[model samples]
Target: MTELEADCSRCVGLCCVVPAFGRSADFAIDKPARTPCPHLGGDHLCTIHEVLPERGFRGCTVYDCFGAGQFVVQDLFGGAAPSPAMFDAFEVVERLHELLWYLADARSRPEAAPLHDEVDGLRDRVSAAARSPHDVDVTVLQSRCGALLDEVSGLVRAGGPSLRHADLAGRDLREEDLYAADLRGAVLIGADLRGVDLGPADLLGADLRDARVAGADLSQALFLTRLQVRAAR
Candidate 1:
Protein backbone atom coordinates (compact mmCIF):
# COMPACT_ATOMS: atom_id res chain seq x y z
CA MET A 1 0.00 0.00 0.00
CA THR A 2 2.97 2.32 -0.49
CA GLU A 3 1.86 5.80 -1.55
CA LEU A 4 -1.71 4.49 -1.34
CA GLU A 5 -1.96 4.34 2.45
CA ALA A 6 -1.03 7.03 4.96
CA ASP A 7 2.63 7.88 5.42
CA CYS A 8 2.41 10.39 8.26
CA SER A 9 6.18 10.92 8.45
CA ARG A 10 5.96 12.51 4.99
CA CYS A 11 2.88 14.56 5.92
CA VAL A 12 2.28 18.05 7.37
CA GLY A 13 -0.54 17.21 9.75
CA LEU A 14 -3.22 18.19 7.28
CA CYS A 15 -5.54 15.58 8.77
CA CYS A 16 -5.63 17.49 12.07
CA VAL A 17 -6.30 20.85 10.44
CA VAL A 18 -8.28 20.41 7.21
CA PRO A 19 -11.17 18.49 8.74
CA ALA A 20 -13.79 19.52 11.27
CA PHE A 21 -15.41 17.42 13.99
CA GLY A 22 -17.88 17.86 16.83
CA ARG A 23 -17.54 16.79 20.45
CA SER A 24 -19.04 13.36 20.91
CA ALA A 25 -18.25 9.89 22.14
CA ASP A 26 -15.65 9.78 19.36
CA PHE A 27 -14.13 13.21 19.87
CA ALA A 28 -13.19 15.18 22.98
CA ILE A 29 -14.37 18.55 21.62
CA ASP A 30 -15.37 20.41 18.52
CA LYS A 31 -12.94 21.71 15.91
CA PRO A 32 -13.33 23.57 12.64
CA ALA A 33 -11.59 23.16 9.35
CA ARG A 34 -8.40 25.12 8.77
CA THR A 35 -8.22 25.47 12.55
CA PRO A 36 -5.83 23.20 14.40
CA CYS A 37 -7.20 20.81 16.99
CA PRO A 38 -6.58 21.84 20.60
CA HIS A 39 -4.58 18.69 21.09
CA LEU A 40 -2.42 19.46 18.06
CA GLY A 41 0.96 20.79 19.19
CA GLY A 42 2.97 23.61 17.69
CA ASP A 43 5.14 21.03 15.99
CA HIS A 44 2.01 19.63 14.29
CA LEU A 45 2.06 16.55 16.46
CA CYS A 46 -1.06 15.39 18.27
CA THR A 47 -0.57 16.20 21.96
CA ILE A 48 -2.89 13.34 22.94
CA HIS A 49 -1.62 10.94 20.32
CA GLU A 50 -0.57 8.24 22.76
CA VAL A 51 -3.88 8.32 24.62
CA LEU A 52 -6.30 9.55 21.96
CA PRO A 53 -8.97 6.93 22.57
CA GLU A 54 -8.76 7.29 26.32
CA ARG A 55 -8.97 11.06 25.96
CA GLY A 56 -12.18 10.92 23.91
CA PHE A 57 -10.49 11.66 20.59
CA ARG A 58 -10.73 8.15 19.18
CA GLY A 59 -11.99 9.59 15.91
CA CYS A 60 -8.55 10.96 15.18
CA THR A 61 -7.06 7.50 14.98
CA VAL A 62 -9.22 6.01 12.18
CA TYR A 63 -8.89 8.73 9.59
CA ASP A 64 -6.71 7.91 6.59
CA CYS A 65 -6.37 10.36 3.72
CA PHE A 66 -4.74 7.72 1.50
CA GLY A 67 -1.67 9.93 1.04
CA ALA A 68 -3.82 12.98 0.35
CA GLY A 69 -2.19 14.94 3.20
CA GLN A 70 1.33 14.18 2.09
CA PHE A 71 0.57 14.76 -1.56
CA VAL A 72 -1.17 18.05 -0.84
CA VAL A 73 1.35 19.31 1.69
CA GLN A 74 4.53 18.20 -0.04
CA ASP A 75 3.69 18.11 -3.74
CA LEU A 76 0.83 20.55 -4.22
CA PHE A 77 1.42 22.99 -1.37
CA GLY A 78 5.18 22.82 -1.83
CA GLY A 79 5.90 21.90 1.79
CA ALA A 80 4.58 25.23 3.09
CA ALA A 81 2.32 25.71 6.08
CA PRO A 82 -1.25 25.22 4.83
CA SER A 83 -3.49 28.24 4.47
CA PRO A 84 -7.28 28.28 4.66
CA ALA A 85 -7.47 28.15 0.88
CA MET A 86 -5.09 25.22 0.95
CA PHE A 87 -7.36 23.45 3.40
CA ASP A 88 -10.35 24.09 1.18
CA ALA A 89 -8.50 22.63 -1.74
CA PHE A 90 -7.39 19.73 0.38
CA GLU A 91 -10.97 18.99 1.33
CA VAL A 92 -11.95 18.57 -2.29
CA VAL A 93 -8.78 16.72 -3.19
CA GLU A 94 -9.21 14.35 -0.29
CA ARG A 95 -12.51 13.10 -1.63
CA LEU A 96 -11.02 12.57 -5.04
CA HIS A 97 -8.14 10.58 -3.60
CA GLU A 98 -10.60 8.46 -1.67
CA LEU A 99 -12.12 7.43 -4.99
CA LEU A 100 -8.65 6.44 -6.10
CA TRP A 101 -8.44 4.16 -3.08
CA TYR A 102 -11.70 2.42 -3.95
CA LEU A 103 -10.86 2.27 -7.61
CA ALA A 104 -7.49 0.74 -6.83
CA ASP A 105 -9.15 -1.79 -4.58
CA ALA A 106 -11.65 -2.64 -7.28
CA ARG A 107 -8.92 -3.12 -9.82
CA SER A 108 -7.22 -5.60 -7.53
CA ARG A 109 -10.28 -7.83 -7.59
CA PRO A 110 -10.14 -10.59 -10.16
CA GLU A 111 -13.91 -10.59 -10.25
CA ALA A 112 -13.75 -7.05 -11.58
CA ALA A 113 -11.77 -8.01 -14.63
CA PRO A 114 -14.32 -6.53 -17.03
CA LEU A 115 -13.90 -3.14 -15.42
CA HIS A 116 -10.15 -3.19 -14.95
CA ASP A 117 -9.36 -0.94 -17.89
CA GLU A 118 -11.96 1.60 -16.88
CA VAL A 119 -10.77 1.47 -13.31
CA ASP A 120 -7.17 2.06 -14.41
CA GLY A 121 -8.13 5.09 -16.45
CA LEU A 122 -10.17 6.49 -13.60
CA ARG A 123 -7.42 5.78 -11.11
CA ASP A 124 -4.85 7.55 -13.25
CA ARG A 125 -7.05 10.61 -13.64
CA VAL A 126 -7.75 10.75 -9.92
CA SER A 127 -4.09 10.24 -9.02
CA ALA A 128 -2.99 13.01 -11.37
CA ALA A 129 -5.69 15.34 -10.07
CA ALA A 130 -4.72 14.62 -6.47
CA ARG A 131 -1.29 16.11 -7.20
CA SER A 132 -2.85 19.39 -8.32
CA PRO A 133 -5.42 21.27 -6.27
CA HIS A 134 -6.64 23.23 -9.27
CA ASP A 135 -7.63 20.04 -11.08
CA VAL A 136 -9.61 18.26 -8.39
CA ASP A 137 -13.35 18.08 -9.11
CA VAL A 138 -15.35 16.59 -6.25
CA THR A 139 -18.77 16.26 -7.87
CA VAL A 140 -17.59 14.49 -10.99
CA LEU A 141 -15.28 12.28 -9.02
CA GLN A 142 -18.06 11.23 -6.65
CA SER A 143 -20.43 10.41 -9.46
CA ARG A 144 -17.83 8.38 -11.26
CA CYS A 145 -16.88 6.55 -8.11
CA GLY A 146 -20.48 5.85 -7.25
CA ALA A 147 -21.06 4.20 -10.58
CA LEU A 148 -17.82 2.27 -10.33
CA LEU A 149 -18.61 1.06 -6.85
CA ASP A 150 -22.05 -0.15 -7.95
CA GLU A 151 -20.54 -2.05 -10.84
CA VAL A 152 -17.83 -3.57 -8.70
CA SER A 153 -20.27 -4.47 -5.96
CA GLY A 154 -22.25 -6.58 -8.39
CA LEU A 155 -19.15 -8.63 -9.05
CA VAL A 156 -18.38 -9.31 -5.40
CA ARG A 157 -21.84 -9.34 -3.85
CA ALA A 158 -22.32 -13.03 -3.39
CA GLY A 159 -24.76 -14.69 -0.92
CA GLY A 160 -22.77 -14.57 2.29
CA PRO A 161 -24.57 -12.46 4.90
CA SER A 162 -25.40 -9.51 2.69
CA LEU A 163 -26.07 -6.26 4.52
CA ARG A 164 -25.63 -3.66 1.82
CA HIS A 165 -27.04 -0.27 2.78
CA ALA A 166 -28.86 -1.79 5.73
CA ASP A 167 -29.82 0.72 8.39
CA LEU A 168 -28.00 -0.72 11.38
CA ALA A 169 -26.89 2.61 12.69
CA GLY A 170 -26.41 3.01 16.43
CA ARG A 171 -27.24 -0.66 16.98
CA ASP A 172 -25.28 -2.75 19.44
CA LEU A 173 -23.94 -5.77 17.57
CA ARG A 174 -21.17 -6.68 19.97
CA GLU A 175 -19.81 -10.22 19.70
CA GLU A 176 -22.09 -11.02 16.78
CA ASP A 177 -21.28 -13.30 13.91
CA LEU A 178 -20.56 -11.26 10.76
CA TYR A 179 -18.20 -13.55 8.91
CA ALA A 180 -18.22 -13.30 5.10
CA ALA A 181 -20.85 -10.63 5.22
CA ASP A 182 -21.55 -8.36 2.27
CA LEU A 183 -21.40 -4.98 3.98
CA ARG A 184 -20.88 -2.74 0.98
CA GLY A 185 -22.31 0.74 1.46
CA ALA A 186 -23.76 -0.29 4.82
CA VAL A 187 -24.70 2.44 7.26
CA LEU A 188 -22.88 1.40 10.40
CA ILE A 189 -22.63 4.77 12.10
CA GLY A 190 -22.30 4.50 15.86
CA ALA A 191 -22.95 0.74 15.71
CA ASP A 192 -21.19 -1.44 18.24
CA LEU A 193 -19.07 -4.21 16.71
CA ARG A 194 -16.89 -5.12 19.66
CA GLY A 195 -15.55 -8.66 19.38
CA VAL A 196 -17.62 -9.18 16.25
CA ASP A 197 -15.92 -11.62 13.95
CA LEU A 198 -15.79 -9.98 10.55
CA GLY A 199 -13.95 -12.79 8.87
CA PRO A 200 -13.54 -12.01 5.15
CA ALA A 201 -16.43 -9.54 5.26
CA ASP A 202 -16.52 -7.11 2.33
CA LEU A 203 -16.76 -3.56 3.66
CA LEU A 204 -16.36 -1.45 0.57
CA GLY A 205 -17.85 2.00 1.11
CA ALA A 206 -19.18 0.93 4.53
CA ASP A 207 -19.68 3.88 6.84
CA LEU A 208 -18.12 2.84 10.13
CA ARG A 209 -17.79 6.31 11.65
CA ASP A 210 -18.19 6.22 15.43
CA ALA A 211 -18.78 2.45 15.60
CA ARG A 212 -17.36 0.56 18.57
CA VAL A 213 -14.88 -2.18 17.67
CA ALA A 214 -12.65 -2.46 20.69
CA GLY A 215 -12.16 -6.19 20.20
CA ALA A 216 -13.62 -6.80 16.74
CA ASP A 217 -11.94 -9.65 14.89
CA LEU A 218 -11.34 -8.12 11.49
CA SER A 219 -8.04 -9.73 10.67
CA GLN A 220 -9.34 -11.07 7.37
CA ALA A 221 -11.99 -8.47 6.61
CA LEU A 222 -11.99 -7.67 2.92
CA PHE A 223 -11.30 -4.06 1.95
CA LEU A 224 -10.97 -3.19 5.63
CA THR A 225 -8.28 -0.58 6.20
CA ARG A 226 -6.69 0.95 9.24
CA LEU A 227 -8.48 4.18 8.42
CA GLN A 228 -11.86 2.47 8.47
CA VAL A 229 -11.08 0.68 11.73
CA ARG A 230 -9.86 3.91 13.28
CA ALA A 231 -13.12 5.67 12.48
CA ALA A 232 -14.88 3.14 14.70
CA ARG A 233 -14.33 2.60 18.42
Candidate 2:
Protein backbone atom coordinates (compact mmCIF):
# COMPACT_ATOMS: atom_id res chain seq x y z
CA MET A 1 0.00 0.00 0.00
CA THR A 2 1.12 3.56 -0.67
CA GLU A 3 2.36 5.47 2.36
CA LEU A 4 -0.10 7.97 0.90
CA GLU A 5 -1.85 7.22 4.17
CA ALA A 6 -2.87 10.05 6.52
CA ASP A 7 -0.35 10.00 9.34
CA CYS A 8 -1.53 12.86 11.53
CA SER A 9 1.22 11.96 13.97
CA ARG A 10 3.68 13.39 11.45
CA CYS A 11 1.59 16.53 10.94
CA VAL A 12 1.62 19.97 12.53
CA GLY A 13 -2.14 19.83 13.03
CA LEU A 14 -3.03 21.70 9.83
CA CYS A 15 -6.51 20.13 9.64
CA CYS A 16 -7.19 21.30 13.17
CA VAL A 17 -6.35 24.89 12.28
CA VAL A 18 -7.42 25.36 8.67
CA PRO A 19 -11.10 24.48 8.53
CA ALA A 20 -14.05 26.39 9.99
CA PHE A 21 -17.28 24.79 11.12
CA GLY A 22 -20.54 26.06 12.53
CA ARG A 23 -22.11 24.48 15.56
CA SER A 24 -23.91 21.33 14.51
CA ALA A 25 -24.20 17.65 15.30
CA ASP A 26 -20.62 17.26 14.14
CA PHE A 27 -19.25 20.24 16.04
CA ALA A 28 -19.78 21.61 19.50
CA ILE A 29 -18.53 25.08 18.64
CA ASP A 30 -17.77 27.31 15.69
CA LYS A 31 -14.15 27.87 14.61
CA PRO A 32 -12.95 30.01 11.75
CA ALA A 33 -10.45 29.07 9.07
CA ARG A 34 -6.81 29.88 9.84
CA THR A 35 -7.73 30.13 13.50
CA PRO A 36 -6.38 27.54 15.89
CA CYS A 37 -8.88 25.43 17.75
CA PRO A 38 -9.18 26.14 21.46
CA HIS A 39 -8.61 22.46 22.02
CA LEU A 40 -5.29 22.58 20.20
CA GLY A 41 -2.38 22.67 22.62
CA GLY A 42 0.70 24.80 22.03
CA ASP A 43 2.45 21.60 21.01
CA HIS A 44 0.22 21.53 17.86
CA LEU A 45 -1.75 18.55 19.05
CA CYS A 46 -5.44 18.14 19.73
CA THR A 47 -6.15 17.94 23.43
CA ILE A 48 -9.16 15.76 22.74
CA HIS A 49 -7.60 13.80 19.89
CA GLU A 50 -8.22 10.46 21.51
CA VAL A 51 -11.81 11.27 22.37
CA LEU A 52 -12.96 13.59 19.58
CA PRO A 53 -16.41 12.07 19.19
CA GLU A 54 -16.97 12.13 22.92
CA ARG A 55 -16.04 15.81 22.81
CA GLY A 56 -18.63 16.46 20.05
CA PHE A 57 -15.99 16.85 17.34
CA ARG A 58 -17.48 14.10 15.19
CA GLY A 59 -16.65 15.96 11.96
CA CYS A 60 -12.95 15.44 12.66
CA THR A 61 -13.34 11.69 12.73
CA VAL A 62 -14.41 11.28 9.07
CA TYR A 63 -12.20 14.02 7.63
CA ASP A 64 -9.11 12.68 5.85
CA CYS A 65 -6.65 14.90 4.03
CA PHE A 66 -4.82 11.74 2.95
CA GLY A 67 -1.33 12.75 4.16
CA ALA A 68 -1.51 16.33 2.80
CA GLY A 69 -1.08 17.81 6.28
CA GLN A 70 2.22 16.03 6.97
CA PHE A 71 3.46 16.60 3.44
CA VAL A 72 2.93 20.34 3.81
CA VAL A 73 4.47 20.44 7.28
CA GLN A 74 7.48 18.13 6.85
CA ASP A 75 8.17 18.14 3.12
CA LEU A 76 7.16 21.58 1.87
CA PHE A 77 7.84 23.72 4.94
CA GLY A 78 10.33 21.52 6.76
CA GLY A 79 8.27 20.71 9.86
CA ALA A 80 7.31 24.28 10.72
CA ALA A 81 3.85 25.25 11.92
CA PRO A 82 1.89 26.83 9.08
CA SER A 83 1.60 30.57 8.56
CA PRO A 84 -1.84 31.79 7.48
CA ALA A 85 -0.97 31.91 3.78
CA MET A 86 0.67 28.46 3.86
CA PHE A 87 -2.29 27.07 5.77
CA ASP A 88 -4.72 28.37 3.14
CA ALA A 89 -2.57 27.03 0.31
CA PHE A 90 -2.74 23.54 1.81
CA GLU A 91 -6.51 23.37 1.28
CA VAL A 92 -5.90 23.53 -2.47
CA VAL A 93 -3.07 21.04 -2.38
CA GLU A 94 -5.21 18.67 -0.36
CA ARG A 95 -7.90 18.63 -3.06
CA LEU A 96 -5.35 17.93 -5.77
CA HIS A 97 -3.73 15.21 -3.66
CA GLU A 98 -7.12 13.58 -3.29
CA LEU A 99 -7.45 13.22 -7.06
CA LEU A 100 -3.98 11.71 -6.99
CA TRP A 101 -5.25 9.05 -4.65
CA TYR A 102 -8.00 7.89 -7.04
CA LEU A 103 -5.53 7.87 -9.91
CA ALA A 104 -2.87 6.03 -7.93
CA ASP A 105 -5.43 3.59 -6.61
CA ALA A 106 -6.71 2.85 -10.11
CA ARG A 107 -3.17 1.94 -11.16
CA SER A 108 -3.32 -1.09 -8.88
CA ARG A 109 -6.14 -2.65 -10.84
CA PRO A 110 -5.35 -5.17 -13.57
CA GLU A 111 -7.60 -3.25 -15.91
CA ALA A 112 -5.48 -0.17 -15.50
CA ALA A 113 -2.13 -1.95 -15.90
CA PRO A 114 -1.46 -0.72 -19.40
CA LEU A 115 -1.85 2.86 -18.19
CA HIS A 116 0.52 2.31 -15.28
CA ASP A 117 3.28 4.56 -16.62
CA GLU A 118 0.86 7.34 -17.40
CA VAL A 119 -0.68 7.01 -13.96
CA ASP A 120 2.66 7.06 -12.18
CA GLY A 121 3.90 9.99 -14.25
CA LEU A 122 0.87 12.05 -13.32
CA ARG A 123 1.19 11.04 -9.71
CA ASP A 124 4.79 12.23 -9.70
CA ARG A 125 3.84 15.59 -11.18
CA VAL A 126 1.06 16.02 -8.63
CA SER A 127 3.38 15.23 -5.74
CA ALA A 128 5.92 17.74 -7.02
CA ALA A 129 3.22 20.39 -7.37
CA ALA A 130 2.08 19.69 -3.81
CA ARG A 131 5.55 20.42 -2.41
CA SER A 132 5.28 24.07 -3.46
CA PRO A 133 1.61 24.49 -4.21
CA HIS A 134 1.53 28.21 -3.40
CA ASP A 135 0.28 30.29 -6.35
CA VAL A 136 -0.16 27.04 -8.28
CA ASP A 137 -3.04 26.62 -10.72
CA VAL A 138 -4.89 23.55 -9.48
CA THR A 139 -7.44 23.83 -12.28
CA VAL A 140 -4.90 22.63 -14.82
CA LEU A 141 -3.91 19.74 -12.59
CA GLN A 142 -7.56 18.79 -12.10
CA SER A 143 -8.21 18.85 -15.84
CA ARG A 144 -5.24 16.62 -16.52
CA CYS A 145 -6.36 14.08 -13.95
CA GLY A 146 -9.91 14.21 -15.24
CA ALA A 147 -8.75 13.49 -18.78
CA LEU A 148 -6.79 10.46 -17.63
CA LEU A 149 -9.77 9.13 -15.70
CA ASP A 150 -11.97 9.54 -18.74
CA GLU A 151 -9.66 7.34 -20.76
CA VAL A 152 -9.19 4.80 -18.01
CA SER A 153 -12.94 4.48 -17.53
CA GLY A 154 -13.36 2.74 -20.85
CA LEU A 155 -10.71 0.13 -20.14
CA VAL A 156 -12.12 -0.37 -16.67
CA ARG A 157 -15.61 -0.90 -18.00
CA ALA A 158 -14.51 -3.56 -20.47
CA GLY A 159 -16.15 -6.93 -19.82
CA GLY A 160 -17.83 -5.53 -16.70
CA PRO A 161 -21.57 -5.56 -16.17
CA SER A 162 -23.68 -2.41 -15.88
CA LEU A 163 -26.89 -1.86 -13.97
CA ARG A 164 -27.62 1.66 -15.14
CA HIS A 165 -30.59 3.20 -13.38
CA ALA A 166 -31.63 -0.13 -11.99
CA ASP A 167 -33.70 -0.25 -8.86
CA LEU A 168 -32.26 -2.71 -6.38
CA ALA A 169 -33.63 -1.27 -3.18
CA GLY A 170 -33.57 -3.51 -0.17
CA ARG A 171 -32.32 -6.30 -2.38
CA ASP A 172 -29.68 -8.88 -1.61
CA LEU A 173 -26.93 -8.24 -4.16
CA ARG A 174 -24.35 -10.18 -2.21
CA GLU A 175 -21.52 -11.69 -4.24
CA GLU A 176 -23.02 -10.29 -7.46
CA ASP A 177 -20.87 -9.58 -10.51
CA LEU A 178 -21.61 -5.92 -11.01
CA TYR A 179 -18.23 -4.74 -12.22
CA ALA A 180 -18.29 -1.41 -14.07
CA ALA A 181 -22.05 -1.24 -13.87
CA ASP A 182 -23.72 2.06 -14.55
CA LEU A 183 -25.80 2.28 -11.40
CA ARG A 184 -26.75 5.92 -11.69
CA GLY A 185 -29.46 7.00 -9.27
CA ALA A 186 -30.02 3.45 -8.13
CA VAL A 187 -31.97 3.12 -4.92
CA LEU A 188 -29.87 0.72 -2.87
CA ILE A 189 -31.28 1.46 0.54
CA GLY A 190 -30.98 -1.46 2.92
CA ALA A 191 -29.44 -3.55 0.17
CA ASP A 192 -27.33 -6.54 1.21
CA LEU A 193 -24.23 -6.03 -0.95
CA ARG A 194 -21.82 -8.17 1.02
CA GLY A 195 -18.93 -9.59 -1.00
CA VAL A 196 -20.20 -7.96 -4.21
CA ASP A 197 -17.72 -7.42 -7.07
CA LEU A 198 -18.77 -3.92 -8.00
CA GLY A 199 -15.42 -2.86 -9.38
CA PRO A 200 -15.57 0.40 -11.31
CA ALA A 201 -19.33 0.53 -10.90
CA ASP A 202 -20.91 3.88 -11.70
CA LEU A 203 -22.39 4.53 -8.29
CA LEU A 204 -23.06 8.16 -9.07
CA GLY A 205 -26.07 9.33 -7.12
CA ALA A 206 -26.72 5.80 -5.94
CA ASP A 207 -28.44 5.78 -2.58
CA LEU A 208 -26.48 3.45 -0.36
CA ARG A 209 -28.23 4.27 2.89
CA ASP A 210 -28.36 1.47 5.38
CA ALA A 211 -26.74 -0.79 2.81
CA ARG A 212 -24.51 -3.52 4.24
CA VAL A 213 -20.97 -3.17 2.88
CA ALA A 214 -19.18 -5.83 4.88
CA GLY A 215 -16.68 -7.54 2.54
CA ALA A 216 -18.07 -5.47 -0.35
CA ASP A 217 -15.44 -3.90 -2.62
CA LEU A 218 -16.33 -0.61 -4.26
CA SER A 219 -12.77 0.68 -4.10
CA GLN A 220 -12.61 0.74 -7.89
CA ALA A 221 -16.07 2.24 -8.29
CA LEU A 222 -16.39 5.49 -10.22
CA PHE A 223 -18.17 8.69 -9.35
CA LEU A 224 -19.11 7.44 -5.89
CA THR A 225 -19.56 10.63 -3.97
CA ARG A 226 -19.11 11.28 -0.27
CA LEU A 227 -22.78 12.16 0.05
CA GLN A 228 -23.71 8.62 -0.94
CA VAL A 229 -21.44 7.02 1.67
CA ARG A 230 -22.57 9.44 4.34
CA ALA A 231 -26.15 8.35 3.70
CA ALA A 232 -25.16 4.72 4.27
CA ARG A 233 -24.72 3.09 7.63
Report lDDT (CA) for all predictions. Answer: 0.78, 0.77
The regions of model 1 sitting more than 4 angstroms off are: 159-162, 169-181, 189-201, 209-222, 231-233
Candidate 1 residue lDDT tens string, 85-113: 67877787778777877787778778779
Clashes of 2: 1
Error of 1 at 85 (Å): 3.6
Model 1 lDDT-worst window of ten: 150-159
lDDT of 1 at 186: 91
lDDT of 2 by residue, 1-233 (tens): 34456777778788888888889987999999878889988777889989988999877766767677877778877777578766876798788778777676567667778888998999888877887787778889888887786567667777556665678989988757776776757889899988888878867557787788778887878756554665566
Q: What is the lDDT of residue 99 in candidate 2?
A: 75
